[model samples]
Target: MSDAYLVRYVGGPLDGRVDTLPGLPDEPRETVTHVHLHGGPKIVHHYDLHYALEYGCEYRLREAEERDLAQD
Candidate 1:
């Protein structure tokens, strides 16, 4: 099964944007991905693993504890 990740924007114009995304490919790849905005659903053009890495964003596996804590 594919893993889920919490993607957080740490810097740049998109800073503070956080969303749950499906785990990327095992190997680094350059491809587009989608992100949901707080106001509404919008497409992020040309989003990819490399782009995320270059922009100071972070991706962490979605752990049970974190998910539970967030709901508390």
Candidate 2:
């Protein structure tokens, strides 16, 4: 399995400007795994980038090629 990295830009919708939270700052989403910046399923931050790796999501990355195509 391998790892991946992602940079996320924070800055949710404006408050009251929409129809959700009246005059409050936009709410932050959850933080991602291994990514402490931006927002994922944990902690909190703003206008930051996050790095995430998903091995299961990329089975092709771990698959064999050419002669091993049948195994794939």
Candidate 3:
């Protein structure tokens, strides 16, 4: 197995972004990323490993919780 592999992000702010992650798909995985909207505060997004395909792994974006939303 390779030391690192490619993963595809689905949905959310990181949608369509490809990243090189270290480790094998032997078990489930989760990842977090940061995004800064134009003229807005930085936001964090969470994703969970969903599928392992021939080309790469797919991570589905998790729904935003109350805390994930920006407080007015």
Candidate 4:
């Protein structure tokens, strides 16, 4: 079994909330499987944090639907 925390990577599916990430405009909806890490402390009000992993990435824009909200 993969030791990676698979559960945390799975979110925003079925509810159509996944449609909200940026750069997904007109793109067929697809699920992303990955992992991230938080450091120092956790903030409830904060969304995803930019943690540097040896082999990982972070988003440059608000996730899809969240971005849509900013458009207004």
Best by lDDT: 3
Candidate 1: the clashing residue pairs are none
TM-score, per-candidate, Cα-based: 0.30, 0.16, 0.55, 0.19
For model 2, residues 2-61, the per-residue Cα lDDT tens digits are 233222332432112212222322333333222244545654222221322331111111
Better of 3 and 4 by lDDT: 3
Candidate 3 local lDDT, 1-72, one digit each (tens): 656778888888778999886765576465655565677777766677777876668888866663266332
For candidate 3, the per-residue lDDT at 35 reads 62
lDDT of 1 by residue, 1-64 (tens): 8556555643334557776667653554433234556776673433333345532335333334
Q: Please identify model 2 stretches exceeding 4 Å from their true place.
A: 12-72
* N/CA/C clash count, model 3: 0
Provide the lowest-lDDT 10-residue window in model 3.
63-72
Which portions of model 4 show Cα errors greater than 4 Å?
A: 1-50, 60-62
**How far in Å is the alpha carbon of 64 misplaced in model 2?**
50
32 Cα displacement, candidate 2 (Å): 20
Q: Give the TM-score of candidate 1.
A: 0.30
Task: State the displacement of the C-alpha of residue 9, model 4, in Å, after optimal TM-score superposition.
Answer: 14
lDDT of each residue in 1-72, candidate 4, tens digit only: 322211122123222122223231343223333333387553221134234232332322237676456447
CA error at residue 58 for candidate 2, angstroms: 22
Best by TM-score: 3
